[model samples]
Target: MTDLCPRFEGAMGIISKRWVGLILFELLDGTKRFSEMESDLPISGRLLSDRLKMLEKEGIVERHIYSEFPVRIEYSLSEKGTALEPVIQEIQNWANDWVTPENAQKD
Candidate 1:
C-alpha cells in the first residue's frame, strides 16, 4: 500500500464526527448565535459547545462577541471553514443520490 496523506487524514478526522458536519452546514447559512444553533440541531448544548470549541480551535470557525446588554456571541465559518463548503455540498449530493431514509432503513 501507499503512504496516506496526513493533510487529508487530519481534515477527515475533524469533519467526520457525528455533529461536526451538521454544525458546519448550519454555519454555512450565515453567522448564528449559540441558542440558534442549539435549537436547530438535535444535539445537546454541552456537546454543541464542545464541538464549537473544537472547530474554533482548529481555525474552522470564528467566534464573535458583542458587548451588548446580554453579551451576545455568534459563530460563523472562517476562511478555512468556508473552503469546506464545496466538499460538504458534494457529500450532500452523494447522500441525496444514495442514502435516503428508505435506504438507510433497509440497512
Candidate 2:
C-alpha cells in the first residue's frame, strides 16, 4: 500500500505551528507591514519574525522591502498561501460554530 500519510503529515506540520494559521489568515486580505501584523496578533515580535521567515521559505509568503530614508517592509501571501483561503474560512466557520470563550473555559 502507498504510504500517503507522510505527505499529509508534512503539510500539517507547517500549518500546525503556533501563530502560523493566524498569520496566514491575517495576510489573506492583502499586504501588511510587520508592525501591523504585530499589532493585530498577540505574538511577540521575535516569534512573528520567525514564523514569517518560515512561511517565506515555504513559498507561502513574500517579503518586500521599500527604498526610503527609513526602510519599510511589507508581507503578503503568495499564490500558494492565497490558495489556503477556503481552508482558512472553513476553519473560521468551525470555530464560530464550536469554539468559543465559554467552550474554551470549560475545557
The candidate maximizing TM-score is 1
User: Least accurate stretch of 10 residues (summed lDDT) in model 2?
Assistant: 98-107
- Candidate 2 regions exceeding 4 Å error are 1-4, 105-107
Clashing pairs in 2: none
TM-score of each: 0.94, 0.90
Superposed by TM-score, candidate 1 places the C-alpha of residue 18 at a distance from the truth, in angstroms, of 1.7
Best model number under lDDT = 1
- For candidate 1, give the lDDT of residue 12: 85
lDDT of 1 by residue, 1-107 (tens): 98779998888899998799999999999999999999999899999999999999999999999999999999999999999999999999999899978675331
lDDT of each: 0.95, 0.93
Instruction: Write down the worst ten-residue block by lDDT for model 1.
Output: 98-107
